[model samples]
Structure formats: C-alpha cells, structure tokens
Target: MRILKKILIVLVIIIAIPLIVALFVQKDYAVEREIVINQPNEEVFDYVKYLKNQDNYSKWAMMDPDMKKTYKGTDGTVGFVSAWDSDNEEVGKGEQEIVKIDEGRRIDFELRFYEPFESTEPAYMTTEEVSNDQTRVAWGFSGHMDYPMNLMFLFMDFEEMIGDDLQTGLENLKSELEE
Candidate 1:
C-alpha cells in the first residue's frame, strides 16, 4: 500500500503546484486593437454606437450567419441590448448591451455570454479624429477568470487570440467605412 500512498502524494503535489502558482497569476485579461478609417470621427462613432452595425464588421458576429438575433430598446443609445444565439459552439449565446456613450468619442458595452461558458465582460470602441476626413478607431475587450480558471491563462494566449479577431474586425470596419 506504500506504492499507492506515494502515487497519491505525487498526484496531490502535481495539482497543488498549479493551484499555488495560480494564486499569484493575474486573474484578468484585456485586449485592444485599432485601425484607421477614412471617415469623420463623428461618423465613425455614430456607426459604432449602434450595436446592430457590428454585424457588418465583427468577426464574431459573422461566424454564424444563421444565428438568431434580437434587440431591445433603441439601437444607438444606452440601455440598448443586442442578443444572439447560435448552435455553433464558438458563437454560442451572448448579449451585448450598450452601457454608455461619450457622444462622438466612445461607446461602452457590457457583454454577457451564457452558453458554452458563462461570463460578463466589458467592451468598448473609441473614435478619434486623425484629420478632417480620417478617424482612428480603437476596440477593446476585457474580462476576468477566477482562481483556478485563471491558470488557463498560462497555457492560452488570450491577448494574441482576441487581438487577432479584434484586428480583423477593425480592418473590416475600416473597409466598410472607407467604401
């Protein structure tokens, strides 16, 4: 039985090591990406303030074209919510609510994901004028994972993964706005 005891001890140590390490690891992650759009800042902000427009540029929104979507309240204002449901695991189910808007500057959204996994995250878009006819658009997403789950951050590059998607969406947005 000493062999069995030693094996159990080894397993416990293996698990405990990660748990201990996770105690010191960061529990939050944030990613931001930006692109230059050949549109006025006001025009870019006006378009981005409407969550409905995301379907035109968001990579995630285009993942499942058949996904069911529903909206509540007005499209471009605070308290507006856009919900989506899809059978695809990656797309899953989620709702994005416009929480705040800074006129022709920034728009903030609260994203709630319910299926496949559950988390409430914050996302935002900002528009700054580069010139009279050009705007710099920045998109950002941030979230947190508690304790042991945060350990996954060690193995996963959420920054690169999410940043790529954000960059793609921004590029798409640039193309849409410029066209």
Candidate 2:
C-alpha cells in the first residue's frame, strides 16, 4: 500500500508540474516563411488574389486532396470568400475571406475554423518586388489560442506543425511560378 501511494504521488507530480508550468508561461506563437519566385510581383499577386487560385494551390497543401471547397463573390477582388470542408482532421474545415488587398503588394484575410474547435483569426500574404523577373512572397498567420488550446501548446509545437506546411506551400508556389 505504501509503495503504491508513493508511485501514485510520483506520477501526479510528473504530470501536474508540466501543466502548471505551461499555465504560467505566456508566449506569442508565430511562424513566417518567405520564398522568392521567378515571376513578377503582379504575376504572383494575380495568382494569390483569386479564390480559384487557392483551389489550385490546395492540391499541394490543403492536406485532403478531396476536400470540397466553395467560393463566393468575385474571384480576384476584396470580399471574396473560400470555404472548405474535409474529413481529414489535419485539413479540418475553414473559410478565408479577402478583407483587404493592395494592388501587387499584399493581401489580408480573415480565417475561420469550424472543426477541432470554432475560432476566427487574421492571416495574410504579402509580396514585394525583388526585381523585374523576381518577387518575394511571405505568408503569415497570427492568433491567440484560448484556454485548453493554450495548454495544448505545451505538448504540441505550433511552429513545427504549421511552419513546414508554409514552407511546402511556398515552395510549390515558387515552382508553379517559375514554370
């Protein structure tokens, strides 16, 4: 009985300490990745400004190849929306609305997720002219995780989970643009 009690106490301390530490740890989580495309800024911006282009890019990083997506409003203009549903948890479900656009410079959006939990966040992609035949594209997402999600960050590294996807998607974009 005494040995069992000792084991139980040890187990509790092992699990409880991490959770307690995580609760007190406050940090901002963010991931940013950039890729240089051989295409001009206007050309790259044109590819990203439309919902249809997202559908085409989804083939690379949307996780579920078969996820169904629907678009609303004009394809290349502000107020456009792209919603998606997927059985794959990695892909889950979400919608992105183009809230702002700056010609060939940047695109800002609102991202809402439905599965795993329901939340909305801001996301953006910006492009800068590197030269006449090259452009630099940067994609970024920023948001706060509420409560349990904040706790989950203790076990899961958001940067690891999402950063590679950003890199992969950008690499694919680079290839597509170069071709």
Candidate 3:
C-alpha cells in the first residue's frame, strides 16, 4: 500500500509540473517572415493579390501536388475563398478567404483549418516599395491556442513548426518574382 501511494504521488508530480507550467505559457502565437524580390512593388503586389497565383509559390500547396482545390467568388476579391483538401497529413484540409485588401499595399486572409483539427486564424501579406525596381513582401499568420491545447506549447515549437514554412514560402516567392 505504501509503495502504491508513492507511485501515485510521483505520477501526480510529473503531470502537475507540465500543467502548472502550461498555465503560464502564452496562449497566442504568431509566425511571420519577409523577403525582398527584385520585382517592382506593383508587380509583386499584383502577383500575390491573386490567390490562385499562390499555387506557384506557396510551400504548403507544394506539399501535396495532387491535393484537390476549389475556389469561390473572384480570385483576388475580398470574399474570394480558396479551399483545399488532401489525405496527406500535412495538407489535411483548410480554406482561406480574403477578408481585406489594400489595393497594391496589403492583403489580409482568414484561414480556417478543418481536417486534423479545426481552428480559424488570421493571415496577411504586405508589399512595400523599397525602390522603383524592388519590393519587400511580408507574410504572417496569427491565432490563439485554446485552453489545455495551449499546454502543448510547452513541448511543441511554434516558430520552427510553421515559421519554417512561412520562410520557405517567402523564399519561393522571391525566387519566382525575381525570375
């Protein structure tokens, strides 16, 4: 009986530590990355404003070339939605819609994931003119982690997980634009 009590105590401590730590972990997370492309600001902005063009440089879309995709509304308009579904674990299923657009300056997206898990997040892309011939493009995603699920942040990496993909997507965008 004493040994069992001791084992129970140890197990409680192990689980308690992480639970306690999770309480203090930040609930919101954001991932962002930027790249400069030699193309002019308008040129870069025009390319990204059209959601369909994403297939050419989006790292996530590249994950599953055969993934099924569907579109609604106009491609670059504010209500346009691009949804994708894939049996591939990484791609799973998700839909992104243009929530706002700042002409040739910025575009904001609302992202909803439904496959492995379900959540809605905000993402955006901005274009800045560095010079007549150069443009800076920034891409970012942000969302809040819910309750006990946020606890996973203690062990899982937020930046490395999605940030790498964001960075890669930016790099691919740069290359595509410069080409």
Task: Score candidate 1 by lDDT.
Answer: 0.96
Q: How accurate is candidate 2 locally (lDDT)?
A: 0.81
Task: Please list the Cα RMSD from the true structure of every candidate, rounded to 1 decimal place.
Answer: 0.7, 2.8, 1.4
Using lDDT as the measure, name the better of candidate 1 and candidate 2.
1
- Where model 3 places Cα greater than 4 Å from the true spot, the runs are none
Q: In order, what lDDT does every prediction score?
A: 0.96, 0.81, 0.92
Candidate 3: residue pairs that collide: none
Ranking by lDDT: 1, 3, 2
The model with the greatest TM-score is 1
Please give the RMSD of candidate 3 to the true structure: 1.4
Kindly list the per-residue Cα lDDT of model 2 for residues 93-174, writing each as its tens digit. 8888999999899899898999867878887899999999899999887778754347777778888777777778788778
Candidate 1 weakest lDDT stretch, 10 residues:
37-46
- Evaluated with lDDT, which candidate comes out highest? 1
Per-prediction backbone clash count: 0, 0, 0
TM-score of 2: 0.84
TM-score of each: 0.98, 0.84, 0.94
Model 1 C-alpha lDDT per residue in residues 116-145, reported as the tens digit of each score: 899999999999999999999999999999
